[model samples]
Target: GAGVSQSPSNKVTEKGKDVELRCDPISGHTALYWYRQSLGQGLEFLIYFQGNSAPDKSGLPSDRFSAERTGGSVSTLTIQRTQQEDSAVYLCASSLALIGTSGRAGGELFFGEGSRLTVL
Candidate 1:
């Protein structure tokens, strides 16, 4: 893919259901991130993965939220037992290098349109 790609642009589900969102980043990008945006609010960092490094899962809001990156190219975010508060736009981004590092244009990020998840 030329840019970050997210699937199922809109999803409406009942409370307590599970949702899986997918992301395919641009080829050769080394870093991937997951973020959440509530209506009228700013992006909240969810998780981050860097090449061969331990993923930073510190931002996940609860145990029900988890993500995994495989082969350093694709990623998935799964939300279990969805709640109304979990409704939001899930965004995925990729960068060639870590932000603030040398080269790679200061870690420019390419973002996907985002997957909108609604819990009824």
Candidate 2:
């Protein structure tokens, strides 16, 4: 019955450091997605997982960005070398598979308060 959860709510880091942010999706939801929203920017798709298959990393800005889903329930987005440009709100969403149109059955996504990353 739990919805998606992200940690830290806010992260401040120096440029060129590494950071890992966590996300927990709702139970029974088989599809998960990660997106980033920079200042005055729209949501940018980062990566997505569907079951045990390879993730879609097409949207990840650079090699420094990566993500993984564990036990098909939780996920973590990692930035290898934090940059000022990476500072933004990372959002996670989940949805049911049947006719899965990106959002969960109530697939609109119950977003976390967001881990606002500030790379100084």
Candidate 3:
């Protein structure tokens, strides 16, 4: 794919179940990001991966949420003991340049059609 790709676009799970979401970023992009959007929370950053290593994971809502990137290409987000409050649209994005630079012009991310998770 030319841009970021996410799997299981729609997931419906029972409360307390575990779920894993997958993301495959654009080739050669060193920066990958995971974000969550819900009614209450407009958008929140979950993690930022530079290559296969995550340097910022402070945005994770709780210990139950985790993510990892492998080979600097594919990434996975896992949720443990899922709660109803965890239901939201998970978005993935990638960019060729490093993010959060002081004066980088036109630094944009290619985002995937978010994976919608529903906890019932």
- What TM-scores do the predictions have? 0.91, 0.87, 0.93
What TM-score number comes out for model 1? 0.91
> Which rank order by TM-score, best down to worst?
3, 1, 2
lDDT of 2: 0.80
Ranking by lDDT: 3, 1, 2
Q: In candidate 2, what are the lDDT values of residues 1-120, reduced to their tens digit?
A: 476888878999999999999988878867777888999999887877886443467889999988888898888899988989999999987766622454425445556667899999
RMSD of every candidate to native, in Å, equals: 1.8, 2.6, 1.5
Scored by lDDT, model 1 comes in at 0.88
Full-model lDDT for every candidate: 0.88, 0.80, 0.90
Which pairs of residues collide in candidate 2?
A: 95-104, 103-107, 104-107
Error of 3 at 35 (Å): 0.6
For candidate 1, write residues 1-120 as lDDT tens digits. Answer: 477899989999999999999999989989888899999999998988896353578899999998888898889899999999999999999898776567555349889999999999
lDDT of 3 at 70: 86
Identify the runs in model 2 with alpha carbons over 4 angstroms from their true place.
98-108
